[model samples]
Target chain A: MQHMTIRKSLIWLGGLMILAFLLYTLLDVSGTDLTPQDRINTFSTRFLGIFIEAVPFLLLGSLVSGLIEVYVSKDDLLKLLPKNPILATAGGAVMGFAFPVCECGVVPVTRRLFTKGLPMSVGIAFLLAAPVMNPIVFVSTFIAFGWGEIIVLRFVMTIVVAVSVGLIFAYLARPHETLLPVSFAPVRGGNWGIQPLPPQKMTLIGGLYRAGRIASDEFFEMGRFLIIGSLLAAWMQTRISQQSLLDIGSGAFVSVLVMQGLAFLLSLCSTVDSFVALSFLNTFSTGSLVAFLTFGPMVDIKSAMMFAGVFKKKVVVYLIVLPFLMTLLIGIWVNIWMMR
Target chain B: MNITKIPAKDAIKIMILFGMSGYLAYTILSENLGNYINNSRFVWLTWVAVGLFFVLGVVNVLPFLRPKADATVLLIETSSIMPKSWIVMFICALPLLLGVLIPSQPLDVKSLTGTLSTTVSVSNTTVITRDPLKRNILDWLRAFSLEADKTAFDGTQAQFSGFIYRNPEFPDGVFMVGRFVVACCTADADPIGLPVYAPQADDLAEGQWVEVRGTFLAGEFRRAITPILQVEMIEPIEQPKNSYLYP
Candidate 1:
């Protein structure tokens, strides 16, 4: 039954990938009247630039994830967290303020932290806050804008949302019963006989070997999703008409939805997303653009999938919903504050 | 049964990742290492990372190369499977269709061209097109002029086009105020000053866009010594297609 399930899933996934490709192609080809050569030039040049920008971050993120899987032990993690969920969530947000991790790097580390016995709420909070609350982000924005008020307002609003959403979910969640089934069985070495044994603790000199093993496994499972997601994002960005998006984002209700949806779909890092959001300054409300920056990296399609892989469906649902709501509130707050 | 088989895939993937990581680290190191090494040229490390990622992406497809079982397993029967070729074709074609063959309004090209042609004013001379040599000399002079906070026009000329927003003191002259070009939004926008004095300045109001041909003169206005332009001619031009640089 398990074997059948795996096969079915594989076939379904393959089919879905094809479907995504066709949809992307149709969207892309339908919009442009460019000749074939022009299309090719556009693809090669644009994709090359994107690859140059994106590949380094992806490689670094994956390597860090590999290191965590191989070197970080689960038992060491549980000792650091508070038993109480509220404190744990708050602690996680505070931790984000110190660690300068972007969203891409946060997912694997968050998953590792979860296995290490950190409460799911705490892990989720760290995931949400780490991308935005970190000092690098704040300092960069301050340098870019040269205004303390904008930086301070963005920081305070983000933290309030992060902590509140995390606490709300923590209160609602039933961790032991609700946690999703993660099919992670650590690899074992020295295979000899018919009996299947549990993963063994290898020597520290075997660090490279262990890291290699973890890296390869993760590279296969996660790498496929990364490439496909990136390609999809690249395609959508190229094909979609920004006129409609700009029009929609100009309004309060539509702006929140479009901003949240685009945040998930684009999968851009926090550092660069701000620049992209800047183009929208004249088109959308300052509040909506704030929502775009604040809400995007915290919860997106890629992050949602990562969360679904580690956390229960209910938890993932809450994580998505909570960010949307909080971003709306933040948007509203910025609007009122600026108006005042 | 196939311990070596598993290790083979693992080893190939490892080598690729390692090569990439090593290359990136080396590149970053080399950027700082140039003082010690005393070499201006070396193979860039980013290329190595690029190569490894490309190789790893290909290696990832190797696992699916195994022959499929003809018979049913786990009480599930399948008569036909989609060809792997079709899947691969679709996957490869995906990026091109979505990324390249799409219509986006050309905004950058228009604004950059407009910015270049716009003129500035200098004393008694219509600097329709600036000599590159003179502009270079003016840049050096601009620093000293800015530090001293004096508004004076040097003989070098520039073509500047902007709205003539006049201050109470410069009602006869023109305070050429323009919106700043920020990477993404107006939050980062800074207003730049390009002062000019033209006969048309009296007709131009706070937001009326005008083109001024002039040369920089050293002088003081308000508190700062600015590089002021002597206007040769002034006129209005329509706003360019893209109000914002990038969307």
Candidate 2:
């Protein structure tokens, strides 16, 4: 009863907050002159642009997650994955070649996999590597940079970062510590028995029907986060100038830090970020450009929000901080090494 | 077995999803998707999303109509609506609603100025063609960035179309004509332009689309050695169907 009361009050508070925001925006729109109106238009356009660009990917992710939930059995998943944690982590890193999903799509899919008895380390590895290690991103990088050492370096560095993060999770964090507390335990009720449905006996038509249902459920669950994440990202993109960061950071270390910071804030997709990074090659150091590509797909403002939906708050913090530090170290090292 | 009625809350949620998907589809069908996403390539992705949304909506609504169907077919279990979920649903729907009610317009010049810095960087690898008349604002910006001596571009004929922009610092009879070049989407778009000098420059208001036939001459703007477009023929033109230039 107390819990219900708290929830009710929270809802009312949310309602009031939203009402205030709407009223404020309306007043601002009506009260402002042309300049403020233009600002509003630009903000909305960017917000919607990020939202529209991400919707398809989010839909694809939910569909794939739905299919996994309905069709793939725990016994089957266990049978397919290696028993050794290190080998499993390595397997997760390269798995993206077969399943190419952007950062937005990877989160739901990773969450689904984690809940399905997959090892936490393996899940972490897959989440980090899949966005960059995939074929589509590889092809795009090749197209952007052509045949070169930078492409090779990017591939190597991504695998190294993913594997390292995976190993760190495996060695340090307990399996239970990595996942969210809610819904991690399997439910042992309902007519479907211990299993949702008899794994082998489930009909194709029934599986697809179930898949549709699961997709819709997952879409709403994840879609809300996507919207909020994209809104924040779009807001930052509109208000901040990339050149300001560039101007301040001159040395190799500062430049890498600045670039990684930009990468997190910009929240660009892995497949196309190479082209955007390419434009910076003239102005930014090579190491900084590399950091932008490496750190972005693994962690960003959008992905961090999505991660909060799946992992505990502490785990999400580690996920963000660890990658930033690791990527920065690698970036600075590369910068110094290349200078010789 | 009787058809299971979809709870009112669930029904509302489904309709909202449908409305959002429909708006996106409408935008694509109308070729105004570019107004939101600068990339033309994403149109097909929007089409796919539309199909998926329709499927999900139908699947969700079916359980209410089919009396004999198993109740488990409904993906979301009908439960009392949580306030948190309601807030999230509202957040999800807010953008789609605003997108529909508000008329679609290009990003204004104010946003362009806010996002771009005072100095723009151009790549040295930018290929400069022999005929400069075909070069756009981006092409000239690139040339200016890479050129060792700005005076080399003097007497070069140039023609391009872009919207007008002027900073208070810009001298009278001089204004910038620029376009936003999008690498992936509008979020990553960068404003690139060249300073144009004409007797009537001050007469043209900002954000007015214009076609300028001019000669590129090395000149100073904002105390920096930048190439200035010496306008020969200037005419007001309608904004391009797609205001953004895709790289």
Candidate 3:
């Protein structure tokens, strides 16, 4: 498996170049008569914007995960989380307060914890809940919505959707069944797993050094997925006119879908999304906005792409599909019945 | 296996990470960072980027200095997390190339698709008390959303700068001072503009940065009586380093 040679590096570069070329053609065919210079400049500005804004959080997540890997003993982590699957998954729903990681940061952190034998339900719940369930986002939403239904509904709905989805995974999935083998760290519940490496004898200073090393390596490991995801999102934003997409679907059911679609497409940070949702107050129903607030933080283009790196492709699909369907039902219910 | 023959993935990792730091620092230093993100909102984050990338770069170097037998086990474990490819390794390094090669331009007419929202409010109550003269395009829209009578904004001293834009819907000799409003990043930026009835707008080219010192009055704009800026003084200005208004 460790057969990578210097000659193989060229292939990666070649793959990226092909991607860039394909992106250029997509724009060209999308009906813009663009000078190549204009296309590259506009797309690059957007691509870098998302990358730069999110990378800080990504690094912070990597750093924390590295710290957790070194500082928190595996036994401590296991003890902290409940062994009862339902209780653990339920606890995971509101566990965002401790981590406070955003959608961009949560994936890597969850993946790291999974390696430490974090339960499937906890990881799944935290993955979905962390973005919306955290304090920063809560405060932001509060400021936007005030002490009212929108704010309370957003949180409750997020927890409901996240926990429901988490329990679904916990009931159905084994750790190995959904996780990448390398991420299956000493997880006993799995059919097979990697035996823990002998603990390194270390001083406090040594631990810090080891943490730094793990974080940097992880930065490279997960960082690539972020870049590619940002690329696709930026490209899509440049070509698709968001206003046109939003102008459609004013009905109770359809507006929820449209708003959810907008959330996925825009991929705005969950903190600022309430303000964006505030703009739709006059046009969209309460439920759709709820869906947007809940679904957006749970699944968006960039975060969805990042999820692919840690979980199996099928698990990633469930990660999206479950949250989407549940949020949609809740949102539609709010529109059709609650608001009425 | 010859240890020296294999290009140390560790060394490549260091270079790529350090390169990320260098690129990020370059953006911050070059003042072109504003073209990509709202610098005012994310200034601290850019510093975090510089520091983290630099720290990570240093961390990668340490593995070589003290290569213990147990470190090989780490090597194998870490290797499994990423796809086995030199290309995949380069993907993290992709931004360095894109940032250096592409000249980051602030969004303007080229990016403004469809009609810009003149009356669309973003619900920022904080700026409702701020002086209208100090308000940007977004603040003005938010202010407008609070008032039922459109004429409440009339005769208010309006002073702000944005790129010039006009659509087919715009009245003749009228152009809008458009600002790209970003909640997070350029990906979510949407063009918002206020109409300005100025004969001089005919001479001003699209996407040209200009400062408008005028008074808002209810006038015919986009086929509606909205708070149209009756331009008193308009001057061509260089594009600001960070042109986006943070919502």
Instruction: Please tell me which predicted candidate would have the highest lDDT against the true structure.
Output: 3
Tell me the lDDT of model 2 at A198.
Answer: 57
Q: lDDT of candidate 3?
A: 0.79
- Candidate order by DockQ, decreasing, is 2, 3, 1
Judging by lDDT, tell me the better candidate of 2 and 3.
3
Cα deviation in Å at residue B114, candidate 2?
3.2
lDDT by residue (B137-172, candidate 1, tens digit) is 223233333343443336756665544455556545
Candidate 3 chain A — worst ten consecutive residues by lDDT sum? A188-197
Ranking by lDDT: 3, 2, 1
lDDT by residue (tens digit), candidate 2, A1-340: 9999999999989978975775455335443235556666777888788778878888888888878877676688888889899999998998788778899899888877776777878889999999899998999998888777678878888888998899999999976677764325542222111136556766787678777776776777778888878877776766567667667875889989998988888788888898888878777777888889999999988889888888888999988998889889989988999888
Clashing residue pairs in candidate 2 are B2-B67, B3-B67
Alpha-carbon deviation at B113 in model 1, angstroms: 20
Question: Which lDDT tens digits does candidate 1 get at residues A1-340?
Answer: 9999999999999988997775556344443344444443433323333333444444555555555555556665667777787887888886766546677557655655554556656866887888887776776666544564446666666677788877776777655544544422222221111122134644563343334333344444444444555545544544454344544545665775677666776666665566555445445666776787778778765566556655667777878888888888778667667768
Per-residue lDDT for B74-166 in model 3, tens only? 444333234436876778778888887767677776765566876564443444667767888888888777777999877889899998886
Cα lDDT, model 1, residue B200:
52
Provide the lDDT at B123 for model 1.
21
Report residue A47 deviation for candidate 2 (angstroms).
Answer: 0.8
Q: Give the TM-scores of the predictions, in the order they appear.
A: 0.58, 0.90, 0.89
lDDT of 2 at B177: 86
